[model samples]
Target: MKLTASAKLVYNFTGPTEVIGLIQASHSGDQTILSEELILSPDAALVEDEDVRGDRRFRTCLSTETSIVYTATVDNGMRSLLPRSGRQHLWNELPPEALAYLLPSRFCPSDSFQRFAQREFGSAGDGVSRVMSILEWIAAEVDYVAGVSTPESSAAHTFTVRAGVCRDFTHLGITFCRALSIPARAVSAYSLDVQPPDFHAVMEVYLENAWWLVDPTRLAPIEGIIRIAHGRDAADTAFLTTDKACTVVSQTVQVSRVDTAS
Candidate 1:
């Protein structure tokens, strides 16, 4: 499927603030960027970089006020796949790159949840089955409340409250997976089905020697999710980060399907 994603952000800064933005659709093997445009008001010099995972980040310095607009046309060729019922990889069998995700991170404290995870999902069978069980438990137990969580909220808080937004859901899922010795990471994306159209957060599990996208909130389909940035938690995948204090004046995000057939 083809998707058009866009975001507009306006911020008021007290002084010159260094900012990093990760609002562009990622270019990966499954997704092709056909066309893209980025507009920075006042046109400051920008530096762009891409991580090993294909997450793109743009850095700049802003004074007073700033407005950023970005648009992209992406051909997402990712297809939904059935869950693999394969055996879970042992610690020694895991790739060196997957080791980091298996450990606890800022928002996803896998170490703290190890006892709870084992008690709740220990008998769920293989890694994939346990992940499915985890998703089911989240869907049945958690409430999708937006304001219930703050930026500082973590998986432990969400587990206590039993409610949160997509970021919380993803964090909790990653926590559970990591607790069970599975490699999981948080993903930020532009999803076509997210209500109120915004930058969406999802979780990716390293299973069958590949990363598979999963949405515990069930707000968007995996196939409709366009990857932006991914990391251990929201701290790494935030769309905008400012070094100095700044107030958000306005922000809007939109993702829509584009029909290719005439």
Candidate 2:
């Protein structure tokens, strides 16, 4: 599938502030970046870096006010549908890198949810079955209320309130997966179907020696998700981070499907 994604951000910085932005689609084996453009108002110098996990980061300094615009067209060739069944690796069998996702993080306190996860999903079997069960439970139990959660909300908080947006949903899913000893991480992406057209949050789980994308909110199809960045939790995948306090003046995001021949 071909997808076109874009974002516009306007901010006011009270003082000199360092900013890191992660709003670009990832360059990976499964996706081909056919065309892209990034514009910074007032033409400030920018530094680009790619992390070990392939997440691209753009660093720049802002004073007074600034605006950022990024747009990209990509051909995502990877399969969107996950397999019905896959073997769940025991902790001892997981690869070294996958081990990190099986632990707790700032927003995904997997350590605190072990007993709850086991009691709720212990009989869900393993691998994809367990993952599907978790998604179903979240869908059935949680309410997708937008203003009910804040940046500091964690999986435990969401579990307590049974309400949150995509970020909270992903955090809760990751926490539950890790609590069950399945490696899972948070994913930030652009999806064609997200209401209000904003950056979307999802989860990726390690199964059958690979990471599979899962959207607990079920707002967007997996095939239409264009991954931007992924990490232990929302703390790592945030679109914008500033060294000093900054006010968001305005922001907009849009994603749509493009004709393959176009």
Candidate 3:
């Protein structure tokens, strides 16, 4: 199966920003279940337009702007895809073993987070039932409201307070997975179904033999869904950043999932 997606974020900064830098992971990652024969572009020139990833790493410098746009297209294999229950676990990075090392930035999976996960999820190791329980509780706890929370919110904060947007939910969920020793990371990108000029977040849990997308914000698992990029946290995949302060006044985005030939 082939999936193509587009994402754009419009920023209305209160003040001018200098040297806008963007770190995007919108490229579709290659997985045992899904082979990324062609990812549009990992990085590209900054414009009020579309972007994609090529085979290699892409980088660019953006002029100070309030809004940023990102995008991706992925060729996914339909068969050989693993079920949620069969996702692989990292025994080597189990909490006991990983606690000593902090997980590298969102780019490299961390050992510290794994150790934290191991300690919490050891009881329910390799059990989809257990993982589902954790996800459900989180969805129920977190409030899906944009502009209400910032990236600073921690996993423990969202879990204990239960009030945040998709980013916070994803952060909390991914952190919990790490705390339990399951390889997990936060996904920041765009969702077609939702209004664009906006951002979305999800959790990618390394389970069974592959990574699966879980949207705690929507309280559902996203399989065969389009992905823009991924990283340790929202900071890693921020679409827009400014040197000075700014306030967004208005923004708009449109996204859709299109099917292509195999």
State every prediction's TM-score relative to the real structure: 0.97, 0.97, 0.65
When sorted by TM-score, best at the front, the candidate numbers are 2, 1, 3
Model 2, 39-69: lDDT tens digits are 9996789999997777799999988788899
User: What is the model-wide C-alpha lDDT for candidate 2?
Assistant: 0.92
In terms of lDDT, which candidate is strongest? Answer: 2
Candidate 2 accuracy as TM-score: 0.97
Per-residue lDDT over 118-208 for candidate 1, one digit per residue giving the tens place of the 0 to 100 score: 9999899987899999999999999999899999999999999999999999999999999999999999999988998888999888887
Measured over all alpha carbons after superposition, the RMSD of each candidate to the real structure, in angstroms, is 1.1, 1.1, 6.8
The number of clashing residue pairs in each candidate reads 0, 0, 34
Task: Assess the local accuracy of residue 187 in candidate 2 as a C-alpha lDDT between 0 and 100.
Answer: 91
Error of 3 at 59 (Å): 6.0
Q: Write the per-residue lDDT of candidate 3 for residues 18-50, one digit (tens) a residue.
A: 433342333345412222222222233533322
C-alpha lDDT (0 to 100) for residue 9 of candidate 1: 93
Write out the backbone clash pairs for model 1. Answer: none
Cα deviation at 18, candidate 3, in Å, is 4.7
Once all C-alphas are superposed, what RMSD does model 2 give against the true structure? 1.1
